[model samples]
Target: MTPDAGSALAGLTGADSVAHWTQRYGHALMDTFGAPQRVLVRGEGPYVWDADGTRYLDLLGGIAVNSLGHAHPTLTAAISAQLGTLGHISNFFASPTQIALAERLLDLAGAPEGSRVFLTNSGTEANEAAFKMARRNTGLDESGNGVRRTRVLALEGGFHGRSMGALALTSKAAYREPFEPLPGGVEFLPFGDADALRAAFADGGGATVAAVVLEPIQGEAGVRPLPPGYLALARELTAAHGALLVLDEVQTGMGRTGTWLAHQHPHLGGGIVPDVVTLAKGLGGGFPVGAVVAYGERAATLLGRGQHGTTFGGNPVASAAALATIGVIDRDGLLAHVTDLGAWWRQQVAALGHPLVAEVRGEGLLIAVELTAPVAADVAARALAAGFVVNPCTPTTLRMAPPYVLTREQAATFTDFLAALPHDLGEATP
Candidate 1:
């Protein structure tokens, strides 16, 4: 539709206008996402306008993918300039932007000497690459004995991705059972249970384990951070047992958690180093890009020539977008802002004394409000009606990952909404 036509469509009654577009969406698009929340016409900074011309404070930040926020000038300019110069090139060839981005990621991740990066178009692809690295690293142990390390340990309530290989590593039964007989050898340990983790490694000294995949903060599982010392123990066990520690930072990397990587946070990560780390989501701001950062010589060389490849990955345009995003995050000092604002915001919400609020958890801007009851869906619906956008991440959790550009005043507006919420909002009707 033309810009003028879209504007005219919005002039209609809000319901009619939204219905028209949503009807078209249902007919044209796949049902994977169920229904369009709203026909978002455009966005700027942390706000978006729907087809009805109504505006909303985008608290979800495109599901934590919009690091620099919507319509960021720097990201746009970088992508445009790179596309004007060079866009896509075969894997046999490389561009300066691609090389620079890879180097930048390695540097930001503090990867040791001999570490390497494998770029991809999304988080799922990054995880898929890490899965391959884990499999390929199953070589002979000491004493020249071949050890078939086929088993990969993952945590319960973890989410890797939807692709075949990545999905195999994911633990949710609903996401796995439908596609039965998935790639085998993935075992799920009870989340945050040190005993369960220790017991798993007790047998065979983890000789059959190829890798232990974990999310420093489990985003999909209601923004739960790993308990203290859990990560350090994993690192020690994996190191002593000759297994790789693969961390999936797809939802927590690139300054989302006030640190470039969540596992780098002193309190959260305890200064432990992982063998492999997968990143995406905010890496390219709103643009699509992902990477597998393999640390040390052993993990870096896991996937050698001809073992893994992607045509559109590491293209000049995507690389430029990511570089520009990183540059803006550094130049604008968003990391410190997220850290400071997130702490204050949580305190503000907690002090409201809202009976519905059970807990406020998460680091940096990735926050979740755990409710005393299973009314997150209702609360999110009310939030939408009140010119805000939030996610019902679970039956009892409301998640918010607003842009780093969000100001204190804007955040206060949301707190005011919470203060004015009806006490009986979630009460069931007889």
Candidate 2:
């Protein structure tokens, strides 16, 4: 083999062989989502190894949760140290790390100068908390026919979570149809078109319009981003209608999109301040943590006593992990690193001249490569064969959410490999 062509072959992680683990170990596990792709045993930096000891470059970053990258020394140390100190206290009390992380998230979000935060275990719960807060703040009880709030407005193709309230906001029909009776009364507006949003809320007397929920940039729809004025328009319309704007930054928050919040992008920010912001994914930096931050009186008086609670939500270990990850990101300048690298990386991939590639989009460490043809699955298999990990958001769309820890050299190498994807897939070879 030529020196640059590749590495060794003994026990190498060829794609077909790695699938064998799904046969051996996966049988014992329940069939939640069919079978496992690979029995990932260890991870470090931007790579993961299967049970056969084959390592592949990881570009997904655990679906954008591993911000500092896998098994990062600082993140690991902080979690371990915190676990040794004070692991869990339930939601009945406050842990210093939890309080500090909440304060840090609110401070970074720049929520009208002063904001209150509600802690939860995951993004769904965080969103659930935000929903409860909005309902509480409305001060219109569901029973009284008092003010009769009719609906919440969510954009089409936007994804928040799988919970009943959040699912009601998600636009995908497949995820919602089966689970009907889902706390209805929400209007679905086509994304990216400000006119649609305006038209939807125009009829409602604004009394029934409780809140407007949307991602600053949509991530699940293969990282589809809104045009410059859409988010700003949503903010304006929501405010005009007396409806609160809820920004779902679960996947876009933290430094994933080069800024602490993706909505901070000038085109999107547009001097808009939201009432509720829900975050998860990158918040804990691979540890399980989620939060709902409420601004003004809307967040303060909502959900009074015994309204909602989570047991393992905001454990000290996860809080420490978030604190360590945030510090390292700021100190190491990873935010700027993601911005510069993200821009350059997308440009290089766009220049690949592959027939299969239709477009590439996203911000910072979150990105997606859209293929003209519906060959994303085959391309992913091919890329895995060549020793890189990627995901197919749709049959024609592939998403890459690499760690902010990815080096420039690594991004460049992936670009080169992506350029060859069309040829490999056409050959019907893996």
Candidate 3:
């Protein structure tokens, strides 16, 4: 090897470690996510080690993707065994695991007998599929003639995804402005404002809208949940005008919020089902898999045979990984465990009397700490320095979506970690 290259390699294998890797990353990788917090090298249940061998509690859980935790034996075995048997196939063929995974998702969603599913590789693709389905289905009537219902409504502070179509549905301006001339026929409304939704329908001539998409709980927007009874009003409004109610449960489904779906939570007043639900994130437990589940006749039949397809959507390996994730969540009774642990963590964190902590809000493993000061980023940095990883969703909000396997001891340790932070957490970096 060349002299400089040899020295860099020696540094990577020696004390410099992630610093050298970080410098190389800045030169070679895109700046989409800015600098990564650390160069993670290894992980176990609720813990990850950086290149320096410093272990962290991993409370962010890969932004809610590691549902079963790092290097989970069940999940790894499922994926590996499936890969060995039949790795991948195009949409022209189907695998038993793929079909079973879809059936399982429908069962967990509590969908009716006629419900159907369309699988994708990520949450963005899942939202895109749902978006296309809404347009294709709502543009035609029972007899398949042309219709004027083409408009779509989404909530402010809602984050659907980052693809062109899903980006249009996402509410953040910064994420949208860079890619202007986005798909039209979409309207943004104040979240949880039932009056605004009703007025929009009335002003748009009632039947001009195709769908209303929403996140049961806004994950990227600091785990902000829908206000009480708001979803019920959304369901009623959409049903009355024949507009589809699409619930983007990408980050809240698959037992993340102590239930199969966050809408099924007792406080949300169960039984208010939506027409479409998009899921991903924790569904595959770190393996890439997404699904768009449609309930009832209208939404289920939206996309016919040839309307939408993906090459690697339901590959056997991904399906196996998802099935294993669901099985573990059920077999281990993680739903109830998450529910009780969330409550306990919230109570303990709030009782810390930390000046920076304003409040803790959210359900199950999806929790957020609203800061009294705009020091969320500083707090996150300090937390990381102390060997715990947390995410700052906004300048004033710190969010955590830890794995379901997280124990009470680990949860309690995080509380103590925060309690030990100094009153002033450096100046808030942008």
Candidate 3 per-residue lDDT, tens place, 40-118, comes to 7778999998777688999999999999999999999999999999999888999999999999998888898789998
For model 1, residues 1-430, the per-residue Cα lDDT tens digits are 5446655534456555777889978988999889988888778999998877899999999989999889999999999999999989877998898899999999999999999999999999999999998888685765657877888999999999999899999999899989988888899999999999998889685888899999999988899999999999999999998899999999999999999999999868977889999999999998999999999899998898999999899988999999999999999999999999999999999999998888999999999999888888888898999999999999999999998899889999998988887887667722
Residue 167 C-alpha lDDT in model 1: 96
Which is the leading candidate under TM-score?
1
Between which residue pairs do clashes occur in model 1? none
TM-score of 1: 0.95
Which 10-residue span in candidate 3 carries the lowest summed lDDT? 2-11
Rank list by TM-score: 1, 3, 2
Candidate 2 least-lDDT 10 residues: 1-10
Where does candidate 3 stray beyond 4 Å?
1-16, 142-147, 424-430
Predicted candidate 2, C-alpha RMSD: 5.9
**Residue 405 in model 2: lDDT:** 89
Question: Candidate 2 lDDT, tens digit per residue, 289-400?
Answer: 8888887665655667788878887878878888898999999999999999999999989988887778988888789999877788887887887878888888888899
